[model samples]
Target: MNTNNKRIKKGKVKKKKRIRISRLILVLVVLLVIFAGAGNLYYKSASKAVNDKSTKSVLIEVPNGSSVKKVAKILKEKDLIKNKSVFISNVKGNEKAKHLKAGKYKLAQNMDNNAIIEKLIKGEVYQDGVKLTIPEGMLSTEIVNKLVSQKFGDREKFVKLYRSPKEFSSKFSFLKDSRISTLEGFLFPSTYYIKKGETEKQIFEKMLLEFQKEYDKKVKSLVEKNKLNLYDTVIMASIVEKEAVNDSDRDIVAGIFYNRLDKKMKLQSDAVLQYGLPERKSRVLYSDLKVETPYNLYLHEGLPPTPIASPGIKSLIAAANPKKTDYLYFVTNVDGKNSYSTTFEEHSKNAKKYHQERNDLLKENSSEKNKTGNDENDNKEKSKEKTTN
Candidate 1:
């Protein structure tokens, strides 16, 4: 009887131990479920929009080389996100987090973390509705005037910004040259859509970026092959832009200038002289030639200090790859045709012929005007006689 009681007690103890173990496991499972639910709720709440019903838009800047943590901080400071930790976690999970670009972004309060992250990753920067068209061969001052006329930027600010090329040199490699003191010939002329509230520096950078693209495509290789100075080539192209009346004449004009440079002769470009004048004129006079400016090619044997104007792609190409020619002199006739000459004597003859032709045409037009006036007077006199009769 004693042995049977011992076995029954041992069985009861074993059953109790098993029941305790099962209860502990059940409690742990319930606790785990509760904690998981809480964690999921916290994640959803943290990742939710800051203001789902808000319609306000905020402009934020994500500066260059900003880390994910910095970006999250910027978002949190801007009130565009509900939680910085959640934002950082979300961005870290995304594969495109590394591609987040720096720029001004237009974000709305209603945007969620995912929406903003996607925008930053895709680099959808803020842009305005204003469209600006900068024409080729326009001076930098003229470009600024156009921008100012459109109420896009301040004149004084643009002037100061363009004069300081070093401010932009780090971003634009072409501006890295030490000799480039001003952003005169570098601003590429193209139609641009100005961003809303963009600074003058940003606006100029847009044009410079366009110039870089064009220079690489159209003129870079040719410039390299010819072993010419990039700045001087631009200066030559600017002269060609002003002097050439037609597309066909650009290459020839560029060649003539090159020949003169090789011979160490004066360029004697009227366009260069005209650029130095206070006001532009239809004809550059003998008195205008005496203007003692560095830009006066009549006095200077080499190119002017800076480009006279912005050059188009055609003029740039022509300067980089000019036509091979023996002719060094050219004159524009009254009919708008250019005559090329290899000798000064031939050039003088051509100039005299064109001058005489222009004078004769002017005299003929004056005589025709006088004849018409006299005929009108005669008709009035006949009418007066008829009235007397």
Candidate 2:
């Protein structure tokens, strides 16, 4: 009886082990069947989406750490792919699933699954709206700098196309045989649309044309009246542009400077000395004034060899139509508001007032720099070095 009982228990144990093994094998076969169906579905759906013809600028954003499944969902939502489940299955089967990068991608409707994967990996046609804004009051060098930084063209190319008379004159008739030394004051300052593959010549012409369009009618006549060259009007306009901060002040400042020019007296403008160099301290030192350059109004009797900066329409008109004033001297307060004087004595008093304000600015700037942990001394040294050079 005991032997029979033992045999029965052994048989029960053997049967239980076989049942467990069968269940595991059954689960594996079921999984294999599911995987095979998924593969077929992926191929079919991916093919259908690839042949679809309704995608218009459909964009998919693949984020960082995204799996193949996540990318498929994005593509489906963007209508770049017909079915997410199949697309994901196909992508998960790919060995190169790790290669899909993070970016905004524009996928064409006619793309195959392979092509869509390649395009996403390549990061094609993202935001597409990169712009370059050339603000008013920039010099030719400054404009070139902006172009080089903004990708309109490079600096050397800009200089060659716009600066070289021989190169520029071939396309622009106005520049042919023109004795203008530099292209400083000629470029019109406004926000411009820059397309890819735009040449340096195209940019120059468009900017120059904009300038011509903004040219005042009276300015053309005034250029004739003064017997002044284009270079002269532009040069004076540049100074007027820098000097006049506001429209009301523009005509008066233009008149004062014009009076000085007509009388052959030194224009005595600190701004001209500061131009073409870096910004200055609150007050220009005697040392700063001693650096010799034609742009220096303190040293040079007349206007600079070229325009100091680009001028606005108001400045241009003011250069043409100067006010009639006996005022020989003008001084601005700390806030750039000014009081004019006819005599040297009255001018001296106003100068003293601004001088005090300038000294205050120096102190305030120093304190601000210290409190903020800024390199005030280094900036001063750099400005000093730049101006001297």
Candidate 3:
């Protein structure tokens, strides 16, 4: 009876061990299957293109304050990436994901996850709009012509909109109690990418917004400390922008203007006369100076009726904070550097010397141009003769 009981217990133990081994093998197979499926899905997502059939490009604008998840969703919605989940995962793992910038991105449907992620991280946006470069010291009329030439906007429309008191008055506080009715010297100079359907008002607003942004705490503090109003500072800065040869000379020129203003002397600037002229000249003629216009500083005692041209930030800063100097006059030398003078006699001597050198350079340039023209004519004649032969 004892031997039978022991045999039964041994059988039960062996049977329980076999059942446990079977359960362990089943669990291992299930885990192996899950891992294999997960690996395959990852490989496909990382390597597969979003749309291999479509080759068309699309413009996607990531809003100014967008998150990474928002960006991934945007790319996914535009069909520029394969999977939003995979893109989010990749961006999460990337250390440079935080540097993604918000802008209009030109993307194609054939890009893979990795390629799209790379472009997003690097801010590789597409530029489909007209890239208009508004150079410093350009008047409103000149700026309008530039935009018209690029076919970005209508000249009359731009001028009308720019000069409209109702359009910008509410937004820019500086426009209130302003001297000039037109937006002449207020438009900040920079490269703007104007979209195909972007309006003139939108473009002008962007420029004005940039100017407002630049006139931050530091610039406002300087303006206040100098005891000068914003309007006068901008007007003087515009003149400084045109007169100064370089950034270093801007403050000195501003100081000279201030000294002249203090002593009731005429601010005889050639650039102001040029602005008043019917047609701009490379050199200001004697008659150009005598022409009566509100912008003519030679005739006017104070600043012109308005700012003659737009001033950059450096010139604006210089106007607000002028360098202290006794020198009241300046002239451009042969090397285009300023020659400062404390008296009229010194300024006259420097002017005579530099003007002669400038005349010589002009003559040399004319000769070179004539020589080049003759060479081109000779080449054309030779080509014609060969063709006839």
Candidate 4:
């Protein structure tokens, strides 16, 4: 009884141990397969997310009547997704492969594989979206910031180029130091669509081309009539652009600036002072008069060295053909929108009034901007005002 009982117990124990071992092995195999599948899926998803389509393209050009296979190859070439073979397989397996239309596709990083594929097959055509609405009379630095925020170009690089425009002028033969120091006045304010990550060279070419076209359309004939060169036109246009905030005032402001220039009086334009300020100043200080910069129209008998800001079409035309007026002085009034004054005394009184008005406007602007949570920009502007005042 004892031997048989002991043998039965040992057998039962062996059977239980074998069952436990088998269950453990089966669980490990399942876990291994699951982990492998998960790893593969993650790898594919991540690869698709980071791999940008066609150098961060806003559009992917698909030739007309291109086959599914051809589109897959193009996507692969663009580094948009993985496995052209796999993509082709998906398309062929898709219920609508035969209906796959072709055209330009706007794509971005982080678009999943299926989303991009659907967009391409649906003939979604969206070219590089670079909509920029440039205002008249913005400083070069402000322009740079706007461009940088829009992701068209690097702000730091543009700033560096703006600071040293002669280097760029050599590259673009049309511009000289006198006409546009660092391409400031020649940028030609307008709504521009420049591709993101575009090279500085490309952006410059686009802007320069725009300026050239504008000159041809608006100012070329007048330049001939007035015996003015491109340089003079741009310089005058810059002043007009700065002074003429409202569209209707462009011609009238041009008349005033031209009259002052012809009379050999200091332009005494606060706009020029604002433009020339690096750190930004609140008011044009007495010491700012002797700032020894070519842009200091207060010291220079003639025009400032170059345009302070990129001029628009209206300003360009106004520079070429100023309205007939005997007014020697003009001052932007308390609103910072309109002006008041003709004689020196009137101008001085307006300036004094605007001094407080401008300060209040600046402080108001600073508070509003800070309310929008841009304390850094507000502080920078305030610092600029302090330096100017």
Q: Which prediction has the highest lDDT against the true structure?
A: 1
- Candidate 4, TM-score vs. the true structure? 0.54
Q: What is the full ranking by TM-score, best candidate first?
A: 3, 1, 2, 4
Any idea what lDDT model 1 has? 0.86
Model 2: lowest-lDDT 10 consecutive positions = 380-389
Write down the lDDT that model 4 would get. 0.70
Q: Write the per-residue lDDT of candidate 4 for residues 255-303, one digit (tens) a residue.
A: 8877777887767666776677676764455556567776777666678
Segments in model 3 whose C-alpha atoms lie over 4 Å from true places: 1-58, 75-100, 107-125, 216-227, 362-389
The Cα RMSD in angstroms, rounded to one decimal, for candidate 3 relative to the true structure is: 11.3
Per-candidate RMSD vs. true structure?
Answer: 13.8, 18.9, 11.3, 19.5
lDDT of 2 by residue, 1-389 (tens): 69999999999999999999999999999999999899777667655655556555566678887887888877776667777776666566677766678876777777767678766666553655446666667777878988888777778878876666565556545455356666678787775666677788878877777777677454677767756666677777888777766678888988888887778888867678877346645545556666787777767788877777778777777787778899887877778787898887787777767756755676778666465335444444533433321
Q: Which stretches of candidate 2 lie over 4 Å from their true place?
A: 1-130, 169-178, 216-218, 225-228, 276-283, 361-366, 369-389
- Each candidate structure's TM-score, on Cα atoms with residue i matched to residue i, is 0.62, 0.58, 0.67, 0.54
lDDT of 1 by residue, 120-216 (tens): 9999988656888888899998999999999988999999998999999889888877878889888887878886888999999999999898999
lDDT of 3 by residue, 273-323 (tens): 788889886556555556899877767888887788999999999999999
Model 1, residue 330: distance off in Å is: 0.8
Stretches > 4 Å off in candidate 4: 1-127, 159-173, 176-181, 336-342, 346-389
Question: lDDT rank, highest first?
Answer: 1, 3, 2, 4
Pairs in clash, predicted candidate 4? 165-182, 280-384, 281-384, 281-385, 281-388, 282-385, 283-388, 283-389
